[model samples]
Target: MAVQSLQAAPVPVTAAGRRRDREAMIAFWLFMSPMLLGLIVFTFVPIVWGFLLSFSRAQNTVSVGDFIGFQNYVDVLRDREFRRSLITILVFTAFIVPLTYAASLGLAMLVNGVNWGRGIFRTAFFIPTAISYVVASLIWRMSLFNGIPSGVANIAIYEWFGIENPINWIAGTDPPWYWLVLVTVRLWLQVGFYMIIFIAGLQEIPRSLYEAAWVDGARSGWTTFRDITLPMLRNTTIAVMLLLFINAFQAFDEFFNVLGGTAATQGNRGLARPPLVYLYQVAFQDADYGRGSAGAFILTAIIITVTVVQGRLFGFGRSA
Candidate 1:
């Protein structure tokens, strides 16, 4: 009998502790109620309404008419403008997402390594995120890429480099130089926001991993980055890419303002009219609300389908 003694099991939580937790949970939900209410009322309600309206034969989006089944969806599917708009968005996304991802990551790496004035650099980069698409487009259109020979871009290429002809950036469709104007402004506006996100992700990675790699005779910086840093940033990269995809799909303000000019004097929208712009024209301008709503749902489906496929491929929610 070698001092056979039974060890006590783990102590149960006190009633007071349980009560405190319950109270804390109540307080949390109480605080969250307002935000939840707002989301339901403003966002969810409108979404549900829009879905319903898509199936209806509504002339103006607000006033609902008789239900027309899937006719509206069928019409929008057959519409050439809608199909073209989808292709334009795909083209835009192909250009913008990769450029933004590379730019932001490079910027983040640079900012992270800076020995001094890091805050200043971060602030300077992030400042552009606060600028509205409307304002940025105006600056690009009215000053930078105004298409005139005296414009900033024209002056840079023609005067500084002594090029014979100033390129008509906006109006020129042959070379598709207008893409430069759109892409540049979007990059300037959004890169800072994504860069900050990358910086946060970079900071979250453990310094010990680099030290361990170094101890294991990994002398090359690029090797350490490839093996440790990139692998560690899987989640952040997935999130950033997903957001980039969604935002790219939602692009409208800059396109409309820069290309079309003012509301009173709309430009040639036939060139690069995205789905949102097409929907806007259909809904508000043309008052074909049912078709517009159908287009909206179609676009939503495309976004959702892409997101689901990507999430699956990336193993977004799975354990590492």
Candidate 2:
């Protein structure tokens, strides 16, 4: 038989089809317009304006005063307090990242293994993520660790551990007991969110892999988890670590609420102050918009650099 020529016919676009296409496009843009408008007005414009302000002498006012040419950056970098704040954030990140990572992962494992009431356990663990950092900070400050004899922690310590002294948890910078308050509140607020992410990752891991490991005599719990669970969750782990690092670096709210003092009292007291808090004091309190903007950019640069380095180390984009 002769091979038939298989010429494909082009479908004609009718006026109705074209009209529908055009209407769909219009509707799509209409739905997207609000978000686009907000992004341009709130995010893009501020970033551009802040960048320009960083290079200017815009003290006490956002109006671009003069083209200072890195004067603001130089001043911000040379500020001793600012350097100390950077160190403080670095320490905080170091402690919080690993602690949060481990806690989240462990909680995820425990929740994943639950044979009953999984939703209840998951919800119970995750509810803390909904609590506001400011509110949690207040709870931690006023009720949990208020340092008063009647406070929860103080009472518990006194009753159980027989510690007579009511430890001034937040104010005692000499021993830096304040870190406990900061770390615990942040940990409580953050772990649940990351734990949920970890649980999702764990669920995605195939049961067949675990079964196969058991067959191979990797029956030991730690061995199976080490060889199977961890490797399977590499990408998820990296993502969680990156988020934890960035969040730790950007910590401000709890620090501010717990430690911030009135202008009359000046209660920052040179302890546990993160870079954001320092920038807030510089920009808002001291009215040094130029330097504040500069410091903000500097912190942004540092974050980007660290993220890049971490992604590289973790092989983030590679298949796990």
Q: What digit string (tens of lDDT, one per residue) describes model 2 on residues 1-320?
A: 23445664454699987997799999999999999999999999999999999999997789985989999999989999999999999999988999999999999999999899999999999999999998999999899989889999999999999999898998887788899999999999989999999999999999999888778878858888898889999999999999999999999998888885556645654787799989998999999998999999999999999999999999999886
Q: Please list the residue runs of candidate 2 whose C-alpha ends up more than 4 Å from where it truly belongs after superposition.
A: 1-12
Candidate 2 local distance difference test against the native? 0.91
- At residue 146, give the lDDT of candidate 2: 91
| Structural RMSD, model 2 | 4.2
Q: How high is the CA lDDT of each candidate model?
A: 0.90, 0.91
- What tens digits encode model 1's per-residue C-alpha lDDT throughout 205-284? 99998888889999747898899888888999999999999999999988898888456766657778889998998888
Question: Considering summed lDDT, which 10 consecutive residues are worst modelled in model 2?
Answer: 1-10
lDDT value for model 1? 0.90
Task: Provide backbone clash counts, one per model.
Answer: 0, 0
Best by lDDT: 2
